[model samples]
Target: MMKSASTASRSSAVHMAVAFIAMGGWAAFANSAHPMPGPLIAGVVQGTLSALITLFLKRMIEALSARYPGSVGTWLPPLVAVLSSLALLSSVHWLAGTPEIVRTMAVPLSVTAVYATVYNLALRRVAAGGVG
Candidate 1:
């Protein structure tokens, strides 16, 4: 079940921070074999994007759930999130010239997919009159 708004805000902040550090670190490490400064630039670029996405993801899901009901609600949000993540991550990484683009994007994409799936399921259950 979800908590109070205050609690949710704190949790979201923590999650965003962790995502920024972890995903950025992973990107940097993944691209470490490249020339100097490349890894650093990639890390900053990816970290910023990851944090922004993390911040918005919950709200996106909630809005999507409310906007589209029933069967469509169950799947559309996750599918949208995954596709959007793919496009954003890939495009940004490409623009940033991030080395090993696929590798840099892998973990974040997987995480987004998993989070979207699990969150959508939870929303579905709650909508179906089950415990949230």
Candidate 2:
């Protein structure tokens, strides 16, 4: 159980890292093509913030599960994380002068949604003594 939990956490972190890098790279490329300011820096900032958010979300989920220990604990944290992360990312991009804030967030938000869903399912399976 413990090992699976550790593995899941590590897996989630790695997934988030890769997603962040990919999304950042794409953002940078898009910004450059549009002749926008600070493409590289913007990408780096987005990626770093994404990774940090993922770390926080993972810890929050674990802590919630530890305290509540049921479906409520399992699902709520990821739900909250996804919503909050989206809001934060959108806010960051908007503040950075990224045009079409909603459009800018589309890919990253999709990636995060997928991650949250998978991570939650994996945790639930592991908790139920199934293969992670």
Encode model 2's per-residue lDDT on 20-129: one tens digit a residue: 79777766765665555667756776777777776676676666555666778667766877788888987788778764456556776776677766777677778779
Top of the candidates by lDDT: 1
Q: Please, what is the TM-score per model? A: 0.89, 0.70
Each candidate's number of clashing pairs is 0, 0
lDDT of candidate 1 over 1-132, digit per residue (tens): 467766866887787888899999999998999997989988988888899999988789988988898789989999999999999999999998888899889988999999998998898888889998
Position 25, candidate 1: lDDT: 94
Off by over 4 Å in 2: 1-20, 30-33
Cα shift from native, residue 81, model 1 (Å): 0.4
Model 2: how far residue 37 lies from native, Å: 1.3
Local error of candidate 1 at residue 10 (angstroms) = 3.2
Model 1 — which ten-residue stretch has the worst lDDT?
A: 1-10
lDDT of each: 0.89, 0.71
TM-score of model number 1: 0.89
lDDT of prediction 2: 0.71
Model 1, position 110: C-alpha lDDT score: 93
